[model samples]
Target: VYVETGTGELVPASLQRAQPALLEIPASLDAYLKSIGDKSRNMIRKARKLGYEFRRLTPEMLGQDIYEIRTSDPMRQGRPIP
Candidate 1:
């Protein structure tokens, strides 16, 4: 199944524990929610109330958007704070 490393890397199902074997089908969202504590869930709710949306990013979309955002110089990128 899908597992996240401690450093926040999303390990694909192909790389999961197969020796002992997991019972359930791999799902990133399910594993992610289980990994976090209750406080995180509360924060997600609070952010959602302020017009935020949650989406799981694909590899291609992540490369274009999130990767670009992180690598870009904050001074050069003038996106308004929401």
Candidate 2:
């Protein structure tokens, strides 16, 4: 009654067609930094020292920001719609 594609390769085939992209979540910040390696860790530390705050934005918050970014493009020639 139901079919699911891209969920994962539930059954193995002689010629496999697709595999889902899997994201691994780190248990802690130390684990995340270790996964990314030293250079990326240093860069992230520097960004934080420079007062950069990384966060998630809701759709409501992104709506106006997205519109502004899209319309601010000089190549669009004053057209608000992309």
TM-score of each: 0.33, 0.63
Give each model's whole-structure lDDT.
Answer: 0.75, 0.77
- Tens digits of per-residue lDDT for model 2 on 1-82? 3334597545544644688789999999888888897899889889999999988978788998887887677566555554
Write down the TM-score for model 2. Answer: 0.63
Model 2 local distance difference test score: 0.77
Worst 10 residues of 1 by lDDT: 73-82
Error of 2 at 58 (Å): 1.0
Best-fitting candidate, scored by lDDT: 2
